[model samples]
Every structure is written in C-alpha cells, then in structure tokens.
Target: MIGTSISRWSMTYFAMALAWLLAALVMMVAGIGYPAADLATPNTLVLVHVVCIGWLSLAMCGALFQFVPVLVAKPLFSEKWELPALALLSAGLVLLLAGFLSLGGRLPPALWLLPLGAVMLVGGFGLVVVDLGLTAWLRPAGPARFVLVGLASLCATAAFGAVFAFALAGCAGSAGEVILAEGIPLHAVAGLGGWLTLTAMGVSYRLLAMFMLSPDVDDQQSRWTLAAGAFAVAVTVAGGALAVGFASGLNVVLSISAILGLASAVLYGRDISGMFRLRKRRHLELNMRMATLSFASLAGTGLLGIALVSIDAFTEQIGAFAFLAIFGWLSGLVLAKLYKIVAFLTWLETYGPVMGRAPTPRVQDLVAEGRATKWFVIYYAAVWIGTVTLLIAEPNTFRIAAVAMIVGVVGIAREIVRIRRLADVAGPQRLPIGTVMPHLLYANP
Candidate 1:
C-alpha cells in the first residue's frame, strides 16, 4: 500500500517536470539573454523559476508526500488531502507562470496570482511538514529527524520567497528590489543547500542502504552534515547580503561562512562516497547512474568555484558558477533522480499486484537509457559550454546556450513520453489514476 502511494506521487512529480521542461524549451527557442532578467526584461529568471519551482520543488513535494510516511512507518495523516494538495500546487505553478510571462518586464496584474498560488502551495507543504513531524514522534527514526530539519529549511526558504512575492505584488514597501536582491540568495541557499540537499542526503542514506544492500552508518554523520549545512547557508547568505549592501565587516563574515559552506559540501561528498564504496550492487541502474553523474557535477562545480574565487573572477561574472551549480549540478541530480524514480513508481503501482502472477518488467524496461543518454549528455555538455561562453562572451552566449537547452528539452521530453506509455499496458497493470501524466517536466537539469 505504501509503495503504491509513493508510486503515484512519483508519477505526479515526473509529469509536472515534463511540463516545466517543455515550457523552458519554448522559452529558450524564443530566445532571451541569460543571467535571467525579470523586471528588466523576461530573461532566464523565468526559466530558473520553471526549473526550480515548477520542476524541482513540485517534484520534491510529491516525492516527499509519499516517502515521508514510509520513513516514519506511519500512514499519511490526511490521505484525503493528498490529491487536493497536488492540485493546488499544480494550479498555483501554472498561475504563477502565467502571471510571470504575461507580466513580461513590468509587474502585471497576474503577478499577484503568483503569491496566492504560492500561498496554497506553502499551506500544503506546512500540512505535510506537520504530519511528518507527528510521525517522527511516534517512529523515532533517524530519517524522520533529518526530514523534519529539511522541512524547517524549506519553510525558511519559502518565507524568504514569500517576502519577494509580496514585494513584487506591490503589497510591500519600496524596498522590493532590496528585498529581492538580499533575500533571494538566502532563499536559494536554504532551498538548494539547506532544504533540497539536506533532504536528498537524508533520503539517500536510507535508499542507498536499502538498494545497495549496505549496513547503515551512524546517524551522527548525517545529523552533523545537516547542522553544518543549515548553519553555513544561513550565515553565508546573510553575510552575502551585507557584503552586497556594502556594509562594513561583511566581507570577512561572508568569507568565513563561505568556507563553512565549502566544508559542509566536503563532508557531504565524503559521506556519499562511503555509501557508494560500500554499495553491494555491482551494476548500478539508471537512477544510480544519474546520481553518480550529479555527484560528479557537484564536485566539478565546487572546483569551479575555487578557481573563480582564487582569480577574483566572481566580481566580473557572478553567475559563472551559479549557472553550473544550479542548472548543472543541483538540477542535474534532480533530473537523474526523477528518471529512476518515475520508472520505479510506474513499475510498482502498475505492476506490483501482478508480481509473480504475471511477467513483470523490471524498472529498467520502462525507458531505454541508450536512447536517453544522448540527451542527458547533450544537456550537460551544452550547459558546460554555455557556462564558459557566458563567462567569456557575456550577452551573446545565451543565444547558443539557449539552442543547447532546446535540444535538451526535446531529448528529455522524448524520454518522458516513453515512460508514460508504460502505464498504457492493459490488464491489472493499468494505473488507477489515468494515462495522462503532467506535461511539465523541463528545466536545464
């Protein structure tokens, strides 16, 4: 029963991710300079939102909704609320995207809709967090605790994002720009480093153990990683704001916090390595393959940051590293995970009952990696080239990069379609929910 629920959730996430990816493909083909402008002109910010909110956040929410209960060995507190929560989030995302695109450069009337939609999404997240917290009390599992902390980080990230949304909607004071510029980095830090990374790490701890057939490590390692990650993000983001604002002593503080952030990543990488090294599975599946790719990207991004900082290139090109980390490393991991997760879910929900009674396809049977690998490779390669091009060439780089993104979108969309067809099989394997999956699966990742 738990597996079935999780499978459904995973499907929802994959479907939404498809739609998001498609939208991004359209935008990239339409062409807009990078660095992702919003108020100045609709730039990559729109793309970024599509990926972050529409793709990553939506997918994460769905995955968590299903996985949280299992982690705590409890049924969902409000199973009835699940569909409504998913609907609200999906609707909100559509409204937000509509509002942003319609607004173009200047704030549009539809812009206010983003916050309203966001509010609904946040409410849903809050409910899940509350339920998960309650479950933790009953279960006493280490993953539950980690998930709770990750939820806390998500709340903080959402709060910061809400501030920006309110400011954008003209509900706040003239400090909107200040709020965006200052609060946004914090939001990113919390979302990426704090919420997403922490949760992924925690989940990986359990999932890796299960799949890799490895013994569990001490929870203290994860706990410390979580603590250090959260603290470093908070400090670095805050200090960065001060530095941007030209406050005295901010540079020193920011530098210290940045160092801490780097340290946290190092610890995370070390822990992940331990898991991989101990993995019993000799031949990793597609999901594991993607995960390996993401890890490599993460390490590469870290190295790039070091190079940029050492040469003091950040002042000249702020996004040079951000582009790679967000689109390349973080989003890459998210996409790779989505691939395996979707297939796993499909196999379970559609085929679990028929297990042993019928010839069931392994999760790998759903999608051909041979066909999909090219796209993944193209996507990441283009991203790499785009990053370097943007750093060296500036405005013109987006054009070529945008084209690369389009190619990626097409490739990913094809893979998603292939996965969707698996549910179309007749007999007991039919998905109870229906055949159509959400079409919003795009983003550079």
Candidate 2:
C-alpha cells in the first residue's frame, strides 16, 4: 500500500489546505457566512467557494498527487509543476474572494479580479489535469479509471465556474448571462457530486482496501458504482447545459440524474460494506473506524438529496444539505485519511532507508490514535449541531457549533503537525540526533 514513491509537493498542498480550512472556519465563526448572512448572497458564496475550492479541492489534489501514481503504477508525468500549480491556485483564490467581497459592496470596484482569478484558477487546475490525465492514460486500470472520470468532471466544473465569473465581471454576453442565471446548480453538481465524490469513491476504494488489508475491489460492484456515478454526472452536466441554453425539459432530466446518482451512492456504499466484510486486517484502525461514520454521512446525503430534488426543494434546502455533504461526508473522509496518510508517508521517509540496519518504528507506532479519537468525536458532533441549527434557522447556535468544530479542526491539525515532527516516536524507536529529516528536495536513492 505504501509501496509507491511519496509526492514531493503534497505536504505543501496539505499545509495550504489546512490553512484555508481554518480560515474558512474562522470566517464562519465570525459570522461572515451562512447563519450570519443569506445563503444566496455574496457573503455566503465566499464561504462556499473557500471550502469547496480552497479546502476540499486542495486536499483532494494533494491525495491524488500521491496516490494516483500508486493507482496506475506509474510515475507522475511532471512533478515539477505541482508547486507552480499551487502558487497559481492560491493567488487566484485570494483574488477571487476579493472579487466576491467587491461584488457584495464590501470593497471598492474590482470586477477585474473576478475574471483574472478565474483565468488563473483554470490555468492552475488545467496543468494538474494534463499531468495526471497523461499518467492515468499510460496505465489506466482499477481506481485510476475512476480518477480519470473525476478529472473530466473537474474540467466541466471549472468551465461552469469560469462562465459564472465572467458573467459576474460583465465580461461575457448572453451566454455568460445564462450561466449566471441558471448554472450554479450545474457547477455544484459537477464539483461536489462529480469531481469530489467520484474522485473520493475511486481513491477510497483503493485506500480502504490497502489500509484494511482487504482484497482489491476492482470487481463488478466497483465497476457498476463507477459507471452509474460517472453517467449521473454526465447527465447532470448535459441537462444543465440544456437548461442554460433552452431552459426547458430540465425537471425530467434532473430527475433522471438524481435517480442515477442515488443508485451510484447505494452501490458505492455496498462496495464499502463488502470491503469491511472481507478485510484481512481483522482489527480496524482509528481512521477506518471513523470512516464508517463518514460513510453514514454519505448515505444520509444521498437520501436527503433525492427527497430535496424530488420535492423541488433542493435550492431552498441547499444550505443544510451542502453542510452535511461538505463537512460531514467529504471533509470527514479527507481528515480520517489524512490521519493515516501523513503517518504512512512519514514512516516511509524516516524509516525506509534504515529498515534493515535499524529497528525502525512501524507506521502504526508513529500514530497516537487514542489522542485523536476525542477530536474526531468533537468534530462530527459539531457538524451535526451546525446542520441542525441551519435547518431550524438558528444562526447564533450555528456559529457556536462552528466554534466547536474549529477547535476540533485545530486539534486534528495539531496532531498532524506532531506526527510530521516525529513527536510520538519515543524510547528505542527514537532517531539519533544527527539523522537527516526528509526534505522536499530529498530524492530517494
């Protein structure tokens, strides 16, 4: 599972993502976003884009940079570009958020920021897509295939986002106007459902199997999950495009999309359960145990999503549903996996060379699982609390829950930092004073 080479820029990506996540949480706790402002306003869009693009996108990209290589059993096409990609993305996000503030009349006239930032974002994401797409093409099997599908979704999401930004900046004609009026839901579906969810499903299939010592799940159930999920996203995009152009026959089309997505979610859940049933590890680790809760969140989101879409209340309830899917499902899964991935990568970097010559610590030895469980408990509890407050229209209570959730995030983040610093490696397993720690520039011999 840890057989592949570690990514050089992944730690940088992780650090930036954590910073964005913390920033978003702080902004929420300060009443900049939902619970403090209306969901459709610029204030809330700031938080949504921050979480979706800045936090979730960065974190997922970091994971894929490392594991996509593993999934395909090939080297990354251009690892050198990763840092530049991050730079462009970070700068672009700052400008985009600024533009959003300008749009809200919270800043001076700066409409130019919108289109410029969107261009940079598109450029940044495009480089990574090209790199990973080439790598997957070389050996697209198993989870890499699913990742490939997710990359396509990423393309569509970015396209829709670009159109929306141009419309906001008054740089586009009727086409961009249509996107501004009718394309936000399409963008959300392409992003949250297609890119994020599909990529998560693909990578998680491998990660869960690897961590649990379960047999590889590239079988029929897994294939069906990918097919249905990909088609659901494709249909959503097509239907959304039709609505943007013609604005007719979308309810039926979206219903079809919703049904396909629901089916995919169910099948994916079944795949996860099957993985657990067949695991050879026997004992579940802390990350794996927490993943069960994340899975439950996914199930709840799918069911709730169908009801909302069926009753034509999705837009009305988007706030609460997005909260559940984003924080509870996607964020939860990313955090849980980060727990294992950071430790594993650290173990490889620190212990691999001296494995035979020294009594190095096992990957698990580097983790203080007991220390992290409480933080996870706090995190999920806060998520539900925040979700309930939103449903009940209790902004103040939601802010309170946001405070608790941020504490959980900060605690978990501290744990990750500790692991990176080798704080838990003790006794006979401790390294000598002169041992050279791994650096981004260090190449494996």
> How do all models score by TM-score?
0.83, 0.96
- Tens-place lDDT per residue, model 2, 1-445, is 4456778888878888888999999999899978688877888989999999899999999889989988888899999888889988999888899999999999998989999999999999998899889988898787888899999999999999898889999999987897788777788888998999999999999999889999887577788998998988888898778865886746666778878888989988888898899999999999999888899888888877778778988878879998999999999999999889888888887777677777887888878999999999899889988888987788899989999999999999989888887888888676753344655322233
For candidate 2, list the clashing residue pairs, or say none.
none
**C-alpha lDDT of all candidate models, in order:** 0.67, 0.87
How far is 287's C-alpha from truth in model 2 (Å)? 0.7
Q: Where is the poorest 10-residue window by lDDT in model 2?
A: 436-445
Clashes of each: 17, 0
Candidate 2 wrongly placed segments (more than 4 Å): 1-3, 307-313, 432-435, 439-445
- lDDT tens string, model 1, 199-308? 77777677667666676756787667766776776675666656656644445665676677778788888888888788788787666776777777788778887888
